[model samples]
Target: MIPTDWIYGLIGGVMIGAAAAMFLLINGRIMGASGLLGGIIDGTGKANMKERLAFIAGLIGVPAIVYFTIGAPATNVSNNMLVLLVAGLAVGVGTRMANGCTSGHGVCGISRFSVRGIAATLIYLLAGGVTMLVLRHGLGVI
Candidate 1:
């Protein structure tokens, strides 16, 4: 049977694609999150730094806004804070090594019909699946 998460993910993908397409069409810029955030932090995307800051603020604050406004559903952490930190660091390292994150490759790259994007997307998916399998099933981390 199809998982509900898959349906949500498909919808999310369509929304992200639409947003990226619109951003590119209007701004002539690729909607890569890391680049945007980095540009803002480094004062590089300054022609629209105000707008960029607003966008980055929205990105970071939206989840908390939603949680506060709509209420947060409880989450049980199977791993400790240290594990979460390590995992985040690993993901950061992986993204740097790949030159982009899944969103950059899967949405922006694919939308532009880039072969590199396609290859990166496949690698991202395979790596994520394998990592999850290793963590949950093999290493019994979760």
Candidate 2:
């Protein structure tokens, strides 16, 4: 039988897609969080610094607002501070190497029918799936 988590996943996917679509449609720019945040920090976004700052601030603060309004998310992450730091650095490196985050390439880029975006999305998914399989099944980490 299909897992019930799949329904929540589908809803999340739909919401992400819709949000990315709206962001691009309104801004006429890619809805890439990393790029947006990076540009904001570097003062190189297409818009003025104030606008970029506002966007970045909104991105950071809106989730907290929503979580407070609803409820905080539960996570099963390890409590190791060193591991978390290394994982975060690795993710930042991967995002740079991939040229975009999953939301940017998988949702916004794919919506624009970019071949590179599609390939990157497939590679990202395949790599993640393989890594998880190896970690859980082969290494028995989970």
- TM, every model: 0.75, 0.79
Q: Write the per-residue lDDT of candidate 2 for residues 77-106, one digit (tens) a residue.
A: 988787688778877778767778787887
lDDT string, candidate 1, 1-142, tens digits: 8999899889978888887787788877777786676666557777888767776787779878989899865777545888799877887667666767776887788877999989998988898899889988999875
> What is the lDDT, from 0 to 100, of the residue 78 in candidate 1?
46
- Error in Å for residue 25 of model 1: 1.8
Best by the lDDT measure? 1
What TM value does model 1 have?
0.75
Spell out the clash pairs found in candidate 2.
none
Clashes of 1: 0
**Model 1 segments beyond 4 Å from truth?**
1-7, 40-48, 72-79
lDDT of 1 at 118: 93
Model 2 Cα displacement at 67 (Å)? 2.1
